[model samples]
Target: MKTKNRILQTALELFNEKGINEVTLRGIALNVGMSQGNLNYHFRTKSEIVSELYYNLVEEMDEAMKKITLDQPVFSLLYESSLVSMNILYKYKFIAQDLHSVLESNSELKVHYLALQKMRKQQFLFLFQNMIAEDLMRKEELKNEYERLYERMNILGDNWINSANLFFQERSSKVAHYHSLLFEVIFPYLTQKGKEQYLKSL
Candidate 1:
């Protein structure tokens, strides 16, 4: 691997092993077997490495989203996407480990994340429209109901990793447990047909 990529990977490993607050650029350089000055050429600060990793995480998630096609049942697509998302998040688990602080300390990343959230909300709205048209979801009957649900989902998505790190003693079950909670957020909005198809797809 190239020096830059190696630094990012090593930084990710260290960040996961030790929380972001504890891991320093010097520590990462040591693990990468490079002098601190050499590492500084690629990333001057720990936050710089973190910012790069955050963008990497977003690119990976965008790739995952691209895998969704119209050929499958919407419910199945959701299930597969949720599972894939969970796996990706787990792979880059440290980003979400100190999510609030990471974003707060970096204005540019916080802005980017907010924009992504807006885009994701539109995507969810589009998906809901499609699901409703296909008899997979009920039309929204309450004011801003789906909107509220999306907010709930956003909260869960943002925090679930940290929550899992704290609550789940075993690493293996963390992704699976949080994944189910995420998918179930939409359950009440599913029509009978949607429920049947969802269960069948599972």
Candidate 2:
């Protein structure tokens, strides 16, 4: 691996083991077996690395979402996307652990996070609309609850890792466990046919 990529990868591991505030650039340098000056050549500050990793996470999620098709069952897409989301969350666990503080530490990252939140809102809205059209969800019921449902999903998606870590020391490591909880939030709202299809998916 190139020096820059190695630094980022090593830094991610350190940050995951320790919160962003607790890990220092020097520690990352030592862990990677790179001199302080050499690490500095790539990332002058830890915040710089954090921002890059955040964007990298966003890029990965976008790539995963791009693979979904309108023809695919919503539950199947949810099943696959949940794994992708969990993998990214694990890769950048520090951010999820202390998302507010990490974003507050950097002005640019805060702005990007706000933009990403908006994008996520739109994406969820589109997903719901598609499911309604496909007869997988009840449009009449969802029309009044879109905002509330999205809020629940956002809470679970964003904080599931932290919650799971607290509740399940061993099971938290499994992506499918987290994904199942996330999928369950929308399950009750599904039509009978939708529920059958979703069950068949498993």
Candidate 3:
């Protein structure tokens, strides 16, 4: 692998095992068997590396979402997307916590986070529209219901992401628990046929 890619992979692994704040440039260099200066040559600051990592992760998610067949049932699409997202979080929980911390502390990261939120909102909107078009939703009133639900989900997602710090510290299972709970709350609102299909798939 290229030095840059190697550094990123190593950093991600380390960050996953240890919280972002605990992983230093020297720690990364030590693990990768590179000099601090060499690491610095590739990434000027920790935040820069983090920014790149976040961008790469989002790109991976976007690519994965694109590969899902739109012809699939809406619940299937949602379940697949949720699994992908949860896998990413479970794999890189520390880096995610670090990114959230940096975003909280830095204005530039906040701007990036806001942009990310917009993209996520658009993606959810598209998914919701596809489900509605498929006649999977129970009520026509659900068009507005989903809009409200999307807002709530966004808030909940943010809370869950930020709450990673506390969850990790407490060694709690809140992340997986909350995700399952949220999905259950939304899944029952589907049409009777849709619910049967979803439950059968599960």
Model 2 steric clash pairs: none
Please, what are the lDDT tens digits per residue for candidate 2 over residues 1-202? Answer: 9999999999888888877878999999999997999999999998899988888888887887787664666787778777777877777878888898987888888898888889888988888888888888887653559878988888888888787777676744556688888878888888888899999888
> All models: lDDT?
0.89, 0.83, 0.73
Tens-digit lDDT string for candidate 1 (1-202): 9999999999999988898999998899999998999999998888899999999999999898897785877778888988888889888898888888999999999999999899999999888888899888998899988888889998998789988988998867998899889998888899999889888877
Q: What ranking emerges by TM-score with the best candidate at the front?
A: 1, 2, 3
Give the Å shift of residue 43 in candidate 1. 1.1
Please identify which of the two predictions, 1 or 3, would achieve the higher lDDT against the true structure. 1
* Residue 118, model 2: Cα distance from true site in angstroms: 1.3
**Model 3 per-residue lDDT tens digits across residues 11-130:** 988887776888899999999999999999999888887777777777787787788787766667677777667666655566455655868867776897788888878887777676
Better of 2 and 3 by TM-score: 2
Residue 153's lDDT in candidate 2:
89
For model 2, where is the 10-residue window of minimal lDDT? 167-176
In model 3, what is the error at residue 160, expressed in angstroms? Answer: 4.4
Q: What's the TM-score of every candidate structure?
A: 0.94, 0.90, 0.78
What stretches of model 3 exceed 4 Å from their correct place? 129-135, 140-145, 158-179
Q: Please give the TM-score that candidate 2 achieves against the real structure.
A: 0.90
Which candidate comes out best when scored by TM-score?
1
